[model samples]
Target: MSQPPPPPPNQPPTPPQGGFGAPQDPPPQGGFGAPPPPPPGGFGAPTPPPGQPPAYGYPQAPQPPQTPPPGQPEGYGYPQAPQPPQTPPPGQPQGYGFPQAPGQPGPYPGQVPGQQPYGYGYPGAPVQQPAPPQGGGRKLSTQMQIIIAAAVAVVLIIAGGVWFAMGEDGGKGADAKGTTGTTGGGGKGGGGGGGTAADGPGKEKAPANTASKVAFQKPHPKVTYLTNVVGSWVTDKAYVKTGINSIVAYDLDKGTELWTIPLPGQVCAASRHTEGNRTAIAFEPAKATPPKNFQPCSEVGAIDLSTGKLLWSKSVTGGQGGDDKARFNEVTVGAGTVAAGGTDGGAAWDLATGKERWKPQVNAEQCYDMGYGGGAGLVAARKCGPYDQQYVIIQNLDPATGAPLSQFKMPTGVEYASVVSTKPLVVAADVGDSAGDGSGISDFFSIDEKTGKLKAKIAVDADRFAAECDVTEVESCIKVAVGNGRIYLPTEDHEGSGEYGQTNEIVSFELATGKPTSDKSDAGDRYSMFPLRMDGGNILAYKEPPYDKGGQIVSIDGATMKQTVLMENPGVESVRRAESSFSVGHSEMLFSGGRLFISEMMISEPSDSGVDDDQFYMIGYTTN
Candidate 1:
C-alpha cells in the first residue's frame, strides 16, 4: 500500500497552541509529520482526498497526513464553530456494523423521539465538559482528532509513541477485568477460553503466517459529552463491547452484528468476570438531562453475553442513611451469583434468576463491602474503620451466601486493592500513595486463600511496571496476569538497542517467593508490550505499534517466558491509525481464537467542533 497523499494548498494552518506554561519553539521543519512546504510548482499541486487513521502506555506512532474530506475541519484540538448535532444516517441500525435489527422500545418517558439509543444525553442540548488541562483549552471533535494530529506527529517520537485514549481523567477507571473467570478471556488473567483444559496451557494456533486484516470497526456512538461505555468481553460465540448505554455482541470471526441490548441508562461499570456467557453491569437508574446530568451509578443488571439480553435490573439501599437506590462502583459474576459493591455497601443476586441473595450489610464498625472480584472464585474488599482512618479488609467469600470464609485486613494507609486473582489470592495496591505516577499500584501481595495469610509482598516501582489500577476501584488492575505460580507485568518503556526510539519487555515475579525473575520477553526495538489477559496457562500480551508498524499479539510461554506471535496487524496507515487508539493501561483489550479486540473505556461527545469523521467504539482484527 502507498502512503496517503498530503493535503491541498488551501490547508488551514493550526492556530498557536496555548496552555504550556513555558514558551516553546515552533514545530520542527522538514521532518516526518511537519506540514510540507508546497510541491515544486508550489500551491498548484493537487491534494488527494482525505484518508488515514491506531496504542496504549507505549507511545503513539507518527500519524499519517490526515486529508479531511472536502468541507471538514483541517486541524485538531481546537474548538470548531457551534453547529446543530446531526443524528446518524438512517441505515446505521443503532450504530452497528454487519447489521442485526434487534427491536428495542422507543425513547423512555419524557425522552424526546429520535434521541440516540446510546443516550448521548438530551441531544438537543450541549453537555458540560472539563476544560482541557494545563492551559485550559477546548477539544477538537472526537472524530476529527487525528487530521491535524499528524502536523504534530513528531512529538510522539519523544513520547516513544503510544497514545492510549484514557480521556481527560488519568483514570478511565482501570481495566477492572483483573479477577478470575472460567471463560471469555478468563477475567483478566486465569485459565479460561482458547479452549484449554484447566490443567494445561493452550495457544490460539496462528496461521503459518501471523499477519491479519481489519475484520470490522464500530463507530463511537454519537454523544455530545464524555460518556462511560465501560466494558469488553470475548466469548465462544461472540465478541462483546459496550456502546454508550448499549451492550452489543458481534460474531467472533465474521464481525457480524449478532445482537444489541439497549439499556435504560448509561453503563457506569461492568464486571470483567463472565460465567460462561453471563455477565453483569452497574448503570444509572434514569437517564441524565441538561441540569441534572449527573446520575448515581445506582442500579445493577445481569446480562447474557452469548445472546444479548438484560436478565434483570435492580438496586438496594445502604447500611448508613442513604437513598432508596444505593450506588455501586463495581459488579462481578462468579459461582452462580451476580454481585455489586459500592458506597451503598454490597448486594448480590442469583445469576440464573434475579432472586436477591443479600442486600447491603450494615454494622457499627462503619463497615461495608466496597467492591468484588469474581468468576473462578468470589472475593470482596470490605471497607471498615472510623472516619478519621479507613482501611480495606479482603475476604474470601462463599459466593452463595456472601459470607466470609477467610479474611485479611490490608495494611494501614492502603485505601484500595485490586484483586489480581481470587483462587491464588493476589492483590495489588499503592501503599501510602507510594506510586506517584497516578497508575495506582506499587506492590503485589500474595495471600493464602484458605487461611487469608500473607505469603509475600512483592514491591515494584511505579516507574518499572506497566500495571495500573484506579485507586478507588477494586478490580481495575490491568497489565497483570497470575498463573504458573507467578505474577507477570510489562516493564515501562526504556531506550531500545536501536539508534533511535524505545521498547520494553514482560517480566515475572514468583508468587511464592516474591522474587523477580530473569525470565523476560522483549518487545523488540521501538515497540512496547502490555499484558492484555491470560489464555489458558500462557500469557497473552499486546505489543504497541512502533513507528511505521502495526500492533502484534504474542503468546508468552508460562514456564519458559518465550513469545510466539499469534496475530500481527497490518501496517497499513489507516488500519494502524485505528489499531493504536485504545487505552493500554485503562482500556479493555482481549485476544483469543485468532481474533483481537480493543476498546476505549469511555467515549466522549464531540466539542463545539461538529466535524465528524472516523471515531470508533470498538475495533476487531482477525488472522488469515
Candidate 2:
C-alpha cells in the first residue's frame, strides 16, 4: 500500500465539492490546506539591505522594534505599522499583520456570508451541502460507492490521461523538423522550442513592498454543478478566460469586459499553449436541452486570444455518413497545427485556415491514438493490445499526415500518462496505481527530444510529493514544472524548519541524470509553495498562505536558486480568505507585469446562503 493519508490540515479553503468532475472527502485532492498551527509567531521574511529599496510591495526591513503594534507580527523584516491590526469581528479567523486598512468594517463584496458552496477547496471552509451531483458520467451504486470510498478514496479525475514508464529503464520523448503552433508554417506539428518559458522571466516589476490589496473581484457566472469553466490566457490587452458556453476577455487592470465569444456548447478541452495569440480547444457541438445535459464532445477549433474570435470550428463526420462526429478528450496546438484525440479517433487541422491535415489513422482495433500533446511539439499517445496486456506509444507526428516521425513504446500497466514537457521530452505516470492518493504520479521519465531515447527515471513517492495529474486527460498536470534542464516539484507539506505548522520546499532533479540537485527553495514556515510555471529559466511559484497570513508569489533564480518575493497579498480577513479560497493546483494563476491574477477553474452553483453568496470568478492584485 502507498503511504497512509496525512491528517486533515487546519483551516482548508472551501470552494465547491466538485473537482474536475468528481467529489472527494477531507484533505480533498488538489486542496490548499496546511498543517495545524502551533499558535502564531514571527515567521522569517526576506529583508532588503539597509539602504537598498526592498523588492516588490514589501515594506522596509524591520529595525529593532522598540514596541509592538497590536495584531501585527512583531518581528524582523516586517513593515512598520501604519495602523493597529483589525479585530476579526466575532467567529472569523484573526487576520494577521497590520493596517493595510484600519479597524474591521462592513462585509466586503466578495465575502460569501454564513455558508458557502461545498468546494474541492482548501480544507475546513464551511460547506452548505453534501457534495452535489456532477454533470456527466454514471453514478456509483451504493455498494460500489461504499467499497470504493473505504478503499482507495482518492480524487477521481475522469478528464485526462496518465504518463508511462517501463520496467526499470523508463523512456524518452519525440521531436522532428515539423510545423505548427505560432510558427508561420501551419502543418506538420512536431518539434521542440515551444515552451513559453524558453524565453525569459516575465517583466513583472516589484511593488513598494510585498504587500497587496485586492485590485478587483470578478462576479461569478452562475453555472450548475460547477462545470464547463476551464482555460485562461493572457494577452497584451486582456485576461481571457473560458466561461460556461463562451470565451470571455476582460480588461487587465479594470474589470471591464472586453469581448465575449459565444459557443454553441460547453468547452470540453483547451490547450495550455497559445501560439501567436491563438490556441486550440475541443467543445461539445450542441447545448444540452433537458433530457440530455451533455452533447458529444466532438468539435475542435482555435481561438484568437486577442480578438475573442473562434477562428474556425469543425467536426469529423466521415466523408459520407461513414461515421458521426469524432469525439475528443483533449486538444493541443504547436507548429501551427491544432490536434485533437481520444478513444473515438485523432485528427488535425491547420490553425490558419481550418483545413484538414489528416484523418484518424489508428482507428483499427490493434491501436488507436488516445490523445495528443502539443506545445513544444505534437505527439500522439497511442494505446495498443488487449485490456490485461496493454502498452503505449508516444509518437512525434508529421502534421500534414498524422504519421509518426519518431516513436517510443511504453511498458505495460500504463493506466494514464500526463505529458509534462513536450520539448524537453518528459512524461509522468503512476505506473501501476502506485500513488494511491490520486496524485497521478509515481515517476517522471525524461526523454531525449531529438532521438526519442530515455534519459533517466526519477521516482517519486506520492505522499511525499505535491504534484497532481488528471487520470484521463493527456495533458492536464499541475504543481510540477520543467525548465532550466530540470524538473521542479514541491515536497508534501511537512514539518517546517520553523517552530510550527507544516511547510514544503521546491526541489529540482536534473533532466540529464535524473538526480536531485543542490538547488532548492522553501515555502517558509506555515506556507506551501508549488512551481506555477517557468519564466525563462526561473520558476514562478505561488506560496499558499497560512490560516491568518496572506498568499505570496515568488520568482526563483534557475542557477543560484535565490528566491525573490514578487507579491504578498494582504492579510486582511476578506482578502486572506478570498486568496485562500483558490486552490493553487485547481485554479488559473497568472503573475506578470507586476500583477498577480487567480481564478477558479469552475464556479459553483448557489450556496444555501443564496445566489448573492456565490463565489467570485477572478481576483486581481498589483504591487501598485
Top of the candidates by lDDT: 1
| Residues 1-624 of candidate 1: C-alpha lDDT, one tens digit per residue | 011212211111332256212344554586324355643433222332345211211113455655666787856844455666555566754442232234433434222243222111112222233233466567555334443344334454333212111111121111111111111111112221123323368657657878888888877677766678788889888898876568888887777889999888899989888886888989987777776576988889888887788988888775653657778888988788899888778899998898998988678788998888887889999889887788899999998898899999899889888888997899988899988999888789999999999998988876677788887888888788888677888777776544455667676666886766434566765667778777777788887766456788888666445567788889765776566555465467888788888777766665444322434667888885
Task: List lDDT for all candidates, in order.
Answer: 0.69, 0.67
User: Could you tell me how far off, in angstroms, the CA of residue 483 lies in candidate 1 after the best superposition?
Assistant: 0.5
lDDT of 2 by residue, 266-313 (tens): 897888888899998889877766655678888899999977889999
Error of 2 at 436 (Å): 1.4
Indicate the residue-level lDDT of 30 in model 1: 63
> What is candidate 1's TM-score against the reference?
0.68
Stretches of candidate 2 off by over 4 Å are: 1-205, 318-322, 362-365, 609-614
Q: How badly does each model clash, as a count of residue pairs?
A: 20, 38
Poorest stretch of ten by lDDT in candidate 1: 179-188
